[model samples]
Target: MLNNSTTLVKGIGNEKAKDLEALGIYTVKDLIEYFPFRYEDYRPKEIQELKHEDRATLIGTVQSESTVRFFGKKKSKLSVRILVGNILLTAVFFNQHYLKPKLVVGETVTLTGKWDQHRLTITVSECKFGVLDSQGYDPVYSVGGNITVKGLKKMISSAMEQYGQIITEILPERFLTSYKLIERKLAIYKLHYPKSFEDAKHARRRMVYEEFLLFQLKMQALRKFHRENSGGTAIRIQKDDVELFISNLPFPLTIAQQRVVKEILRDMESPYRMNRLLQGDVGSGKTVVAAICLYAAVTASFQGALMVPTEILAEQHYHSLKGLLEPMNVTVELLTGSIKGKKRKDILARLQSGQVNVLIGTHALIQDEVVFEHLGLVITDEQHRFGVEQRRTLRNKGQNPDVLFMTATPIPRTLAISIFGDMDVSTIDEMPAGRKPIETYWAQHHMLQRVLGFVEKELKKGRQAYVICPLIEESEKLDVQNAIDVHTQLQQFFTTYQVGLMHGRLHPSEKEAVMKQFSANEVQILVSTTVVEVGVNVPNATIMVIYDAERFGLSQLHQLRGRVGRGDAQSYCILLADPKSDVGKERMKIMTETNDGFELSQRDLELRGPGDFFGSKQSGLPQFKVADMIHDFRALEVARNDAVELVTSEYFWTSPEYKSLVMFLEEEGVLAGEKMD
Candidate 1:
């Protein structure tokens, strides 16, 4: 019955059903579960007790006859003087001329609107005849597509009334009893028609918990399935050989790096497949750790593959890894979209023949033509840049290979668990030895002359600088500095120095050429967009000037700042911005105070929210209707723990207590067609 079409609800026909479907409500269950975004409190209050600008309900008797006056075009204003207690208040309604006939001089009426204390006026949004007998709250739905809020509310109420009783509880009985949660049916009813704010709060809590628990249960099930079904080849590498390789490296591993490497190696050696995330700040030596793991797999007579988002990043990894591993007799090859003809064929043939011990490339690595003989370890750099399916495809190329995902973007712990719950997380918290923290400063556009003077000093010292603008071209709507204009300005100002321009609009080869010039000190100043935010590494660059820095998120500012501090020289990041909004100002302030990407990421989540934190692609974070991952993180933690416990139980799938949950998971397609054994 709950699965019946929404047309089954009263007052809903084919057209109405289409409107509801536009809102993602196709079935009766979806209709009832479409919870109100907010509620309007219609509880009457005295004018004296209500604050100015408060949305309040007032009960009063009409002291004056309602007057209607026509205004601009079809607009009309209706006003009436209502007397409550000893006070006379004016009630004004816009475009509600029909109320004039209903407002009798002595009749009592209810008015709800914004209250103006100084004027003793109620800008009435809703006016009704007679006072309410008791307090009431109206649920407000976010409606669209020819469906009014009133219509959605009516449809949802009808659906709940008809099918609420049959909405089975998916949670186990023990959980409900232990958590002291109300029944699912009551919760659904209260969510749509809450008698009080407390009732609404409790109902929302129940729904949030249920949503999180179900999601975590799915994660737990996926983790368990991967561990059991995706058998991993235990890479038999001697500890002495691993130690010898680490000791031979030019740089010693930091304590944090050592710990993370140990965790990754353990996963590789275990019988279960490795599903891990390596999170480190920019220039934190994550690539070195990945190199060690790749070496381990290669030494164990298995091929290794590394995939990145961009061609330049792939080539950069290829050159660095070749330098590091080639001496160890590890045959390394690069496969990118640019590699063509005989070169590409030779690499593919070598990969298939098990001669290419390690292959590095962009999306070309996932192409059907590329095959590996004994692909054992798969590592993806900047994992968030690739879509979920893209990453999965690369992993599928190899048979249950140990997979490690590396990202320089530090995710908050709360988000990591929610988004990457199935994968083991290892964070490199320490920067490499002798690396200097970049000094960050915020400035307004008026201080550009002084900032440029400072940049000139750095250039005079034979150091390079990066000038970043938010836009590639002039935006007619936004009055901000653009890369083209900035590049032209810098070129004119610093005529003696070579200033190379780069933006997303540039071809990949063109961008790579510009980057190479900057890296080789041929370009003393690089004026580019945020394309330099990720993989461009120039240790000689000591100054970073970002115009309209407030337009960028905190995490992005951090990434751009990271490009400079890679060298031993003291680096500085200058933010030229005069933000009009408080959030923008706060972001600039936060960037200047710390270089901790994780800390900045948390603040970014709080300021810009999860949707904008990762720049539109939420990186696979589940969307919850009522549950806010940031605010309701405690609930998420609780749900995750509960899910782990329940999934680990021997009778989770077969027991009668969990039958409803199992059925719900299957019905919702969360189980992915996995059956009970």
Candidate 2:
């Protein structure tokens, strides 16, 4: 049945196939499964339902011949008056000269489209050669170049009608019954064209459940596979060394940090490969905890690899770890994309010989040539930036290195399990002592002078200011202003203070130079994009000014704000918003009300939903339909508990019902990272 299916056949010329390949579509199966984002309820409306104020769909017939109006373009717009009983509604079709002939005079037609009451017009869609009858929903695909809703609907209907039967039932019958799952083929069929709302609802529910369950099964399978196959290299560390490392720190470790450290130690001692995730809020002393683990690896006489996302972060970690471990006689080397020539060769050699006890770096560390002499600990800071595959490469650097994944982004508990099922979890929920809350404000354009005045005052007081812009380049589509323009403008505006620019487009050296100058108090006003949102900790910088603050996500804004308030001085974050739109008001409110990144993230999750939760380039978790990481948190928790209970029970991997699920996970293992498909 699958072999004879339409989904198995290609439907394009060679040239068209190449074009489709650009969009990552190769086969008929890809096209058929490319489901619509939403279903538009464009079911034909009754004539009696029509009102002057409300926008309604109205069926009509052309009372007279349609006319075409041609401007500068070759194609003409069809201008026709649609008749709904005695009432005549004016309708216009743009770039559709062919539609004029289709709307025959004195012929009845059904128009299922939006009505403009103010303009007194009806936009026709699905204009069948008949009067209005029963209503039904229609599928609407996400807009692409030249892809019309009508065309998509027709293609989808054709695909389903011809190949729907061939879509194999992967889930076992007993499993379906246990989960109360609807039939796969029936759900897909009804989803595209449901006879009733109840049918649509059922189909939607079934699809959502399937999406969640399949994803869950995949993660569980991977977890089991890794545990069974991979043998971990456990590093035995003396308690005295870890305690001494902790005691030497300038500040005391928070309870959360201590708890996470204990968890790491526990994992290090375990026989199984330790895949643990250490999640904490910004400035939650995660670095100290990581440093302690590194100390443990050094004490155990094994090399450690600390992988970061960016070169700047690598440098920062290098300096930070060097400062902490230099006293303990543990050598730390930094390796990144920026490290080239003799210096790079030296670092690589040192790493290879195990002369460098702890190696901190970016992607450069994961290169095949770089060898580790008994590398027992693999710590990946900011796991969101490095996907599971990326981390796996780093892990494979040593034979089953105990992986410790760290992230500043504190996700909700339930989401953590779904995202990191292959890894054990540890969370640092506390901030170290003397950490002051940044004073946040939602400054409108009208208060720009006030914000500038505050920056000027801070600058005069020998403190630096960070002026953050949303974008690097001006985009006509987006309302957010650019950092380059802001930098140029600020240089002129604040002639007394030195202004520096840093963004993604800048060379790594140039960025480093600017950041160095900013840190040294040479650049009083550092106008930057979100590039410095994470790295470069300058306590001297007390003021943060963000332009078009509404354009940034809540967590991002929080991260940006985190750049300031690192010192003893009272820091302030002025959020510049456009007064015309209430766009950034919620973000501003959240920023002002709390200094807690977790709370702000929760609020952000509530407002923005889970689609862009971990940013566009999705990381750890599989794409979930009904399981919202924030809103549907309860459902996620239930799923997690159910999964855990099942995994712990005799029925986990041994059960017959879970066989297909394990296979699915093994198949999709490469893609499931963090909310990534």
Candidate 3:
């Protein structure tokens, strides 16, 4: 029955199914799992109870209605007046002509919005034609495409009624007894149209717990699979060689970097495969740690490859690592999409010949033509930027290579333990010596000229600056400053200095060229978007000015701020925002207070929620419908423990009691290439 098409439901046709498909609701199971993002309380109140700032819902009869346009054809309004008992309440709706027919004179309707007592108007942000009472909380689903909110609700209700009998409970009885989780079907039933807030909360808890459990179980399964596959070429620990490589480096390794290098060495020498995350804040010497790992592997008579997200990052790593490793007689080669003719051919040939001990490149390293002889280790920078499939493909090039994932994006300890539960995490918490923290200041629009002057002063001192805006070009719908407009303004202010523009829309070569100019201190100022948030390192750029700072998340703002202060020169970050706005004020305060990324990440998680904190997908955490790791962190801990035990237990592999879970997990795409049942 769950296999039935949405067309089986009343009022749903081919067009509706196509729309539903856009939302990934292709079957009965999919429809039920597409839970509401929020709820709307439909409790109606009397007109006499309405106040100036009160958000209220009132049931009344329409006494008068008219349409008016203020500016153009697009600027339309539907003026409506209704009588609740003897009190008259007016509602003004802009550009919503569809309400005119439904809201006829003498017809009773339920209108919900903020009341304007001075004008005696209630702006009709939401209104339904028929008068209705509260059925507790009405769920508001995420709907788009050609599907309307009401239409989605009706179809989901129909699907549940028709297929509820076929909705099998996958969680075993032991889980229910141990965890006190609500019944699966009951949770689904009440979650869609909850009887009360209490029931909704319970249902959400059950679902969230289940999602985290499954996610943890999947990770454990991947871990188990990797362990069974046997690590490719384990590189034994070589302390003297690592020390020599560090001593030969241009800069001294910090205590944190030295500690992490030892940790990585331990992982590489282990009999099992190494799945480690090397996390560090900006300029925390993560690259240096990765270099030590590469050097360790190469010295053990094996080849190592490093993959980055962008060509510029690849080039930076290639040059930096080459300067240090080549002195030790280790051959380091760079290969990228931009490399052409004999150069690319030579790099590929060297890799196959096992002559290139260390290879650095972008996604091009995963190409079929790029093969590694005696490939012992694979290292990835900003690993989240590459998808699981891409990483898997790259891993396939070698024989179960020891994998090391490096990221500068800081993850709070709580999230790291739960998200990267299967992998060992090593953090470089200390900055290198002589590295100065970027001095941050919050500024309003009035400070634009002052900030420009500071940029000019920095340029005069022979240092470069980066001005980051949130947009590429002026959007017709948004009011934020775009890079293009900012670039134009900055060019006028810095007449003698070069001001370059770069954004995601720019061509790859153009972006590379602009970055090179900035890195060489040729571009005095580079005006760009958050595309520079990740791995474009220019130590010469010392000043960072962000426009409309309120629009960016705290973590993102921190990343943008990281672009500066890479050099020894005292750098500054000027955030331009409205100082009065709550989000703006709070963000500015937090930024100016500290340079601690983990602390900022915790605050960011608190403010933006875990799903949006690092973004659901990019953080390598699977999407959870109602579960928030920040709010339900304890639940994640409980689920993770239970999942780990269950997945690793021998009983789970052979027992009939777990057959349904095995089948469901496989169907749910959590098996990680391992089949069950």
Screening candidate 1 with a backbone cut-off below 3 angstroms (N, C-alpha, C), the clashing residue pairs are none
lDDT score, candidate 1: 0.89
On residues 565-617, what C-alpha lDDT tens digit does candidate 2 reach at each position? 87789999998987454546767777889988878777887777666777776
lDDT of 1 at 526: 94
**In model 3, which runs have C-alpha deviations exceeding 4 angstroms?**
1-168, 243-263, 309-312, 326-356, 361-372, 383-397, 411-434, 469-517, 527-531, 548-553, 578-586, 599-623, 669-677
Backbone collisions counted per model: 0, 8, 0
Please write out the lDDT profile of model 1 over residues 439-459, one tens digit for every residue: 999999999999999999999
lDDT of each: 0.89, 0.75, 0.84
Candidate 3 C-alpha lDDT tens digits along 1-677: 77777778767788888999999888767887889988877678776776787888888888986666566857777787888778887788888877777778899888888888888788878888786755848898998888888988888888888777777776888888887889888999989979788888889988998888877777777677666665445577567987888897888888888888878888788777788899999888887788888899987888898999989999999999988788888999999998989988998998899989999999999999998888888999999888888898987887778999999899987689667877878998887878788999988888888888888888888989889898998899988899999999888888998999999988888989999888887888999999999998898888999999998888899988898887778999999998557766888899999998888998988877667777655455556788877888898888888877988899987898888867766776656566221
Which pairs of residues collide in model 2? 218-665, 619-673, 619-674, 620-673, 620-674, 621-673, 621-674, 621-675
RMSD of each: 3.3, 6.1, 6.4
Worst 10 residues of 3 by lDDT: 668-677
Per-residue error for 132 in candidate 1, Å, reads 2.1
Instruction: Please give each candidate's TM-score.
Output: 0.90, 0.74, 0.75
> What is the Cα-based TM-score of model 3?
0.75
